[model samples]
Target chain A: MVVSLKDIAARAGVSLSTVSNVVNGYRPVGEETRVRVQSAIDELGYAPNLSARHLRLGRTGIIALAIPELDNPYFAELAGAAIREATSQGYTLVMEDTAGSYEHELSMIDNSRRQIVDGLIFSPVAVSREDVLARPPATPMVLIGEGVYDVPHDHIAIDNIAASHVAVQHLVSLDRYRIAFIGAQAGDHRQSAHLRLRGYREALAGAGLPWDPALAAPTTAFGRADGLMAMRDLLARTQPPDAVFAYNDLVAIGAMRAVAEAGLRIPEDVAVIGIDDIEEGRFSNPTLTTISPDKEHIGRLAVQSLVARIEGKPVEPPYDVQPPFRLVTRESTLGGQRPVRT
Target chain B: MVVSLKDIAARAGVSLSTVSNVVNGYRPVGEETRVRVQSAIDELGYAPNLSARHLRLGRTGIIALAIPELDNPYFAELAGAAIREATSQGYTLVMEDTAGSYEHELSMIDNSRRQIVDGLIFSPVAVSREDVLARPPATPMVLIGEGVYDVPHDHIAIDNIAASHVAVQHLVSLDRYRIAFIGAQAGDHRQSAHLRLRGYREALAGAGLPWDPALAAPTTAFGRADGLMAMRDLLARTQPPDAVFAYNDLVAIGAMRAVAEAGLRIPEDVAVIGIDDIEEGRFSNPTLTTISPDKEHIGRLAVQSLVARIEGKPVEPPYDVQPPFRLVTRESTLGGQRPVRT
Candidate 1:
């Protein structure tokens, strides 16, 4: 049972305000009264409801994680990691799924701030840089995605450009040419997609391969279904690429399935790679070869950064957190190459 | 941007409480002043902070969904569904991951009640019927997951015993006599696990097959890794079953992986099936066959039940909610039998 502060006050023979002052150290109280209140608190084993305590101090001990898709393995793992890190720091984490709506993302920002949350760890799908900039955030927020808000306020990101370049270059190292860049979100300049496309082009030039726009498979959405559809369209073309660097693990997994359905073997018929080392990627038919962004560590850093801001600590300039990345070599991209399926 | 009620009050030249009283319709106000205040509110586009309003009214438009593991796809899907349902009914859903800990589940219950959340939709992993009855709920709560909760609190459960019986019956229909029931947690009588075991045993008895404990592959935990380890151990035995019925989709998935590694063809060699038709199951190497509980509908009901209670509506006596179930047939348990991979 929770022992409320009122119970402590009653036992101490003091008013609620007196007990509050003693608990919060908000104002000076007589030594005798303070001692009596303290003893009463100790005797009752009072564990203050964190919410009330946070409210009095202009906080709520609650941080919200706003993500685009909770069902997405990437976001699920990130949420799990974040919840653990936040709970370890004596804070509760509440997850909000925006369901890939930009306007909904904005409301989440407003809701988290208004509903007593101390901070927000946001992974926005819809809201744009202009939206974030025009409406400055009311609460301390740490964003996890490619650069969206130019005006920095604690954004955590993996270098999409560098990561994409690495993914493509790794395929080139495998002596695979005719590389396809799957999941090209043409007009949507969401940092991750746009930057990744740019990196793919750069990597092609570096590999001494001519740019082929036809090989860039455009996807309407960043999911397995989109990848499958795009890959199907690519295969229907005159010349399908021998290799693909998908948008993310989901896209890659989908594209690989298409390859299998078309009677082709992984790596041998069409090598595939993606970003986000999600759990599904590890368990897929042929384990995925992808970029691992140490998401768990990044989650921990996000929590620590938010906590520092919540406690009124000064966060340094260049408020961007760039964690290290790894290339997970797996069967999908590596099993010894054989003659391509007709 | 959210326009606060305080802004409206200032514009109307009224005190905060007067403006609140007018907006809430708690007390009568002079017609002229009410019109003046309403116009000002409309002009200012004042939106009340739900949490603050709830502080006065004691019904925050927020509910928490507490689950064992957020990383688990089933829970993630359930959370996504719950979020949608709650949002449709004008409530925000906050997810709490218990991390498969009983103590954590208890704390989540306490925290949700203590925090601003008006109600809780909980799927507990640890706390027992004794713990629950001993410390009657402090706030309106609806429990999910079978029948460990005996006391009449709002509960949402899939009839575990019946579901398991159906699963085993399906496997038996496939003309497989040596059916192994995987993931039998012996001592821990958490409703789902305990009842599932009972159903499996009952199904065998009904089939006129003598109970052979050797074919019951008991698992220490309910994850894919545990499923894999248990299956591996079962495979090492001199007499392994011709078919397997796993605890859940995740466990089934792991066991399937073990079957593949052991050079056994799915269905053709060792037919396998599981419960919880998770998305991953649909896309596994050879698509998994499993039971599909209408989790989305169940999630919606959970929210509605809590909302009804929060609105002070009298909940009926039979607080248990049992959603309909389905058996999905897929390649893993069907597809024309190929020669055993030996």
Candidate 2:
């Protein structure tokens, strides 16, 4: 006879959700409760029939992963990591490459005529207050990368502001004035980018350096091309800054390319740094010195968080998981060490 | 007044499968039959109710994408492309990161008891024939990348042998003999890697050069670290090879690093090339000279084929998609030029 979650719950003397939570390992059950559930499961030889459960729940066991695009390796890596985590947890992920579009993102959530998934792990290109509040999914949802400030759901993200500040501070500590900012966004509310930019400003202010608007160039997108464009624009300026902090590695790579095109050497003539510490960053012409997000950890955490929420567990206040970002000072930012902060 | 596949099928006087085939745009119906289907769909305003149809068919509207690892950009890009295409066809994708284990791949399929979605797009790292046929999924399956041969599923992959042949031929054309083959897998049926290796040998055979086993260093895994180790091993041999052909871009990057560590210059000292012209390949130290699979096209086609199979259409036999791979020779193989191939 096929043992069921119901039978397990009955034997364990717990709520059905509790049985589900135990089976899913989404939430931490009390030791005694867990032992009872395990004993009941072992006694009944109960197997979680996903197909049957899927039928009753009307769940497709599919989740939508709305990422920006594949052109950038960061999104590619994030998507890959998420897929790995999701599959392990018994969820299938379908991808929506919006190329960072508000309309496409909104359409993805709004146009329900075509989707059959139970939840969404949306990483929007940019977040709007209206967009965040307007359409929260009726199904289980999780937010990654971008934060939906007012909207509450399971969110997994890196502290963009803190990450940027860390990056800028690293550069400043190296005593490299004439620091430039690349890859700023106009009216950006994704918070990460704006916050990172803000961190750059704060670091400069803390260092008593004048905030130079000419030094900050906002690109149209977050990628190699955008980085190159921003760097090229910076290079063409009357006074190109010495050390440049790019939005991410792709932008940093682009800036390096533009720097090469301009016949200036990296770190020597113009020290360059970036974020997202993509694998390529380590092998670029002048290996990039940048801030890196722990992609593997993030992926694992996102899945664990979603699974928890699915089981109705109380998680940490929906704050970003500031997985320690590392500054690998490579050829691009090789300089004499600066004094440390107390 | 929701439009359904049945409404169109009834109006067209065709089987529901035929109607589904038409809607998914997989099989080619006769001109007269096409017209009838179109007219029926138009008259009924039969917009596919992606959700309810998914419910009735028990389609989670999710497809599982199993790849080795996203740590490598090639798989990451492939996942992104697959997800994007799947999204366009109104399907969400569930990703499974196998990390290159046949057991893991098999377990994912076996445990697919969830009936989450209608199909799977699997890029198996290591699945034996017996194992594959032993517990095949009731749902349609499409194989991508690794372990294509003998798998009873619709397989989508680049012509690895031909692509490798092209890489070697390009190296030969440059008259760089004493070529070292880096990142050759020891024992594997991943036709792409094996074929590419064969192609390298074939090019040598075609050019009347000896296939030097000493120069062929096989690596345990296809990654940067492995590539470096393989290259280092090759460099330590009796006589260093003049040029190197890596299994993939990550391998190439690793080999490039090893060459640099050994104080050799790219192309000038030891020309290096790779396959899967990953994004980083273009921006690497010497800019990798490699073969580029139309990954975007591959991803789109995989989804299209899987969707067709799930919708019960007669898909073409599982054959290698020898989509035109280009020889993108950059700074690594300095003198080589890119042949304009799609």
Point out where model 2 deviates above 4 Å.
A1-66, A75-98, A107-120, A135-137, A294-297, A314-322, A335-342, B1-60, B111-114, B135-137, B314-320, B335-342
Clashes of each: 1, 9
The residue-by-residue lDDT of candidate 1 on B138-228, one tens digit each, is 6678888863567667888888888988888988888888888888877775558888889999998998777888988888778787777
DockQ of each: 0.34, 0.23
What C-alpha lDDT values do all the predictions have? Answer: 0.78, 0.73
DockQ of 2: 0.23
Report the CAPRI category for model 2: incorrect
**What TM-score, over all chains together, does every model reach?**
0.88, 0.79
Error of 1 at A136 (Å): 4.8
| Shift in Å, residue B154, candidate 1 | 1.3
Q: After best superposition, candidate 2 residue B215: deviation in angstroms?
A: 0.9
> Residue B132 deviation, candidate 1, in Å?
2.0
Q: Model 2 misses residue A303 by how many Å? A: 3.2
